[model samples]
Target: MSVTQQRFMRRGVTKFLFLKAIADAGNVPLRPELASANATDLSGAISDVAGWSLANSPIDTPDMGSPMTTNIPGEDKADSSSLTFYEDLAAETIETLLTKGVVGFVVIMRKGDVPASKSMDIFPVRVAGRAPAYSAGSDPAKFTVTFAISGEPTLDAAIPASS
Candidate 1:
């Protein structure tokens, strides 16, 4: 019997882009356009990223006739996500652009920057807050920006060929 090879992926290959010009009125840029010069590539500045998942809330349904209580999945919602970046005071950096109340789209390419092959997640978000994380020791200065998902996200969408 012949065995098939299974390969695993690494998180280091992921790419994060912040598109500040995208409006909050349900406007989603085409997949190909996400890699354009307009989008800010935040991969170099970011140190960590967390929570961009859509989770379901379970609703309990208890009936009078049944001995056991039943539950069903309720509305799906994307939880508040955050991105930690190495603080940059230079002009037009992410720390300056991701101020409070800023609205934009966060494009995450999980399978690398290959066009027309890998998939990505598009999140319409509003900047909830941005706070600095100062350390007393030898650690580098960083800041975390929280985002509230403003609209429905495009999950696992295919990346189109670059124009």
Candidate 2:
């Protein structure tokens, strides 16, 4: 099996086959509630993929490029359109797994992007938490935030340092 496919199996992400449909577009967290992902999470590669935390990314990524428009001869404006970029929650999950636990990461990619079908996949290593790690339903001590690292999708990335 392919490495990406294998990783998904290991994460128990196989619960959904729909991911295969848009694999190129990117993957989303199977369980979003755990980390509480948002648009910041699914904003895709290179703005430094990380879990959405106001503590770190206080501001959203600035606009990359304006949308294209067609104007007839001397027309003032044809139609206003704008294009935006975003990261998928997978990276966000990895980031969560990293901070809440002493985490590790693996960044995956297929060779030769000439076809544009090729892409990279990121996953996280389960960290040994400084505090004792608790499984769901065990009733261990919980953290303060509205969300605790649990069933939500966790990525290997850690929260960025504060400015």
Candidate 3:
């Protein structure tokens, strides 16, 4: 087997691995299946690194369709799809906390050596959190986490980069 493939299998699935895989793929647009596969690998890796099961904790799967929310009309429809996705997955991450009476948090990805998008390709993951790692005021560990509630997100970027 290829060395790269061998390396990938060693890591468990998680958002961190998901992003890295996407970045490494370069000009290649990452399909949902590929992303899901990596997330699986990354999760295991993270469990090993953190010595905890954060990667598979609530165990979620990457989206299996286009990042675009069905190309349907109305901004609300698009927004709902995007929000539901994050809510479901994010919930898993924070599910244990919820039953113990916890709600809402600022889940940050905290930038490192990670770079911004160059291909203009929107990552299919429901929520993305990134920042400039070397910037003075920037926290290298500060990353953004997408949030959702009541079947919709408070913020939706489905319209591309029109913000």
Native-structure RMSD, model 3: 18.4
**What TM-score would candidate 2 get against the native?**
0.16
Model 2 regions lying over 4 Å from their true place: 1-97, 102-116, 128-163
**Rank ordering of all candidates by TM-score, starting from the highest:** 1, 3, 2
lDDT of 3 by residue, 11-121 (tens): 221233232233332223234523343333222212212111111123234466756334323333323111111123233542222222222221112221123422122
lDDT of each: 0.81, 0.26, 0.26
For model 1, which pairs clash? none
In the range 10-113, model 2's lDDT, one tens digit per residue, is 22211111111112222322223212322122223222222322122233333447454433333122111111122233444433433443432223232211
lDDT, residue 38, candidate 1: 68
Superposed by TM-score, candidate 1 places the C-alpha of residue 52 at a distance from the truth, in angstroms, of 0.8
Candidate 1 C-alpha lDDT tens digits along 57-133: 99999999998999999999997799999976665477667889989889888787767654678898999999889
Ranked by lDDT from best down, the candidates are 1, 2, 3
Best by TM-score: 1
